[model samples]
Target: GLPPLAGFFGKLHLFWCGWQAVLYFLVSIGLLTSLFSIYYYLKIIKLLMTGRNQEITPHIRNYRKSPLRSINSIELSMIIYVIASTILGISMNSIIAIAQDTLF
Candidate 1:
């Protein structure tokens, strides 16, 4: 995920732990892979924003016009999940403290 998302923090924490453990090679490899993944993600986002997928556009338009285009339970759940994750990411330090307190 992006900077404002949990995935970014999770990866960052993992890399930090790896560094603390002296796993330099593993950390380097992970950082390299993350960079490649970010590059692809940005490429995909650019393609989407540019509407380069001509074939899918028509299908998407048709889907939007369909009566079944109404938001379903699955979409609602996904929206809720995104909102919750964003909130959790923002409050992650508190969550880590809570977990450490419970675990220790």
Candidate 2:
């Protein structure tokens, strides 16, 4: 004879163990990717900060030796955007994880 409520018990266990675990897994992956992006942005910032210059260089009003030419306003805005996206993305994903935990 089949036991009564076996299916319900099984589903409850899966919900508490399997789905919860998967939510955490996805959150961790998102966080790791965000951190990696942050690291890459910092590396670029460092390269731009410690670049070389010369006194006998060609005449120019604003000179930047980095690969992307001088650090213009647009470049600064892009760097800021990349940094902000990384932070915001991580935070939003974390909030989602928390919400899921609270809901279920």
Candidate 3:
């Protein structure tokens, strides 16, 4: 999440400079990587969803049900962190200013 957050701001700064050639190249690379990631992630999710308890190992199937209650909280926190970082990247100008000041 942090890496993506940083990348979002970096790309935003690049685009803001009106460097069309570099920006387009970087964006194309980003799109290709994103598609690759989506493909693998979806494949893993499909594999997990399609599996039956009978097909899984007995030790894994014996897992406690208590952990299920905490999954909602964990997912909620992760979602909030992602949303907050995206908002920070989009609405805050200080990050771009600092990055420009330091990197240039």
Candidate 4:
């Protein structure tokens, strides 16, 4: 079994590569985080609709259209920007991979 999270980070630091400096690194991380966010977004919707967290309380009804959270303009634009950047970065990665394949 793994030692602990601190030991894991220490080992990760030991293996840090030059690719960490590249723009594509952030792009890949952002893309993965975006997917994770979508998963949680679905979870929140399920919680609201099914009143999964409302069992403890009885006043709140899911029948009403109550928006407990919302996406503001800045947040919406950032999401769009991140999605576009991730797509472009993944496309660039594909091209690079193909080029590397042809070279070898």
Candidate 5:
């Protein structure tokens, strides 16, 4: 996920914990994999946003002016999810406190 997203916070906490525990190897591996996954995530986002798939046959591409038609509901939900994740990430300490209270 992006810097402002929930996944970034989750990974950050995980890495911090690993560092605190002195698990340097695991933390390094996790960080490396997370960085690698960003490329794939961005590629997927680009495809969704652009509605174009270069892998598709030219015949099929020509058949539809837009290869991937936009769905209003999906777009709306995506927007909502992104907003929620950003808000949650910013307020992560509150969430952690609540979770700790409930768990303990």
Candidate 6:
């Protein structure tokens, strides 16, 4: 429902047309590509679902804290922006609406 969202819609339209279109081959290719994409999407999902049991290393640095022992304002704002954009992008038709709302 992300990158191949439009492709799925196209597939539906093609099927609705009873497969009598001149570009039936294109539809077939699209279907095959969509099928292949499922493998990749599921692979990513599987990787995310399986968590690592490794413990955090003490040597790892924490950049979230500023040198003055306070939380960094800029870093916090950027994190919020990234989170908001991701949520909005998934909820809306496309990011164009978000961009327009942000810009204008």
Write model 6 residue lDDT over 1-104, tens digit each, in one string: 34567756766776557466667777688778878988888776775678542333444323355688555787779999999988976877666877888999
Q: Against the unseen true structure, what C-alpha lDDT does each candidate score?
A: 0.86, 0.65, 0.69, 0.63, 0.86, 0.69
Q: Residue 1's C-alpha lDDT in candidate 5?
A: 59
Q: Tell me the lDDT of model 3 at 29.
A: 72
Q: Once model 1 is optimally superposed onto the true structure by TM-score, how far is the C-alpha of residue 21 displaced, in angstroms?
A: 3.3
TM-score of 5: 0.52
Off by over 4 Å in 5: 56-104
Q: Against the hidden reference, what TM-scores do the models get?
A: 0.56, 0.30, 0.33, 0.29, 0.52, 0.40
Best model number under TM-score: 1
lDDT of 4 by residue, 19-96 (tens): 365656665675566568657766776887896685434544434433664775657799999999889877997889
Query: How large is the C-alpha RMSD of every model relative to the true structure?
Result: 4.1, 16.7, 7.8, 12.4, 5.9, 8.5
lDDT of 5: 0.86
Tens-place lDDT digits, model 3, residues 1-104 = 12456665775565556456657676667666767876777666676898745655677677654654866655679999999989997977988898999999
Q: Which stretches of candidate 6 lie over 4 Å from their true place?
A: 2-11, 14-18, 52-104
The deviation in Å at residue 91 for candidate 5 is: 18
> For residues 1-104, could you state the per-residue lDDT of candidate 2 as single tens digits?
01254554664464457556777675566556656865776666665687643432465426455776667766789999999988987799788999999999
Residue 97 displacement in candidate 3 (angstroms): 14
Q: Where does candidate 5 have its weakest 10-residue lDDT segment?
A: 64-73
lDDT of 1: 0.86
lDDT of model 1, residue 75: 76
Misplaced by over 4 Å in model 3 are 1-22, 52-104
Ranking by TM-score: 1, 5, 6, 3, 2, 4
Ranking according to lDDT, highest score first:
1, 5, 6, 3, 2, 4
TM-score head-to-head 1 vs 6, winner: 1
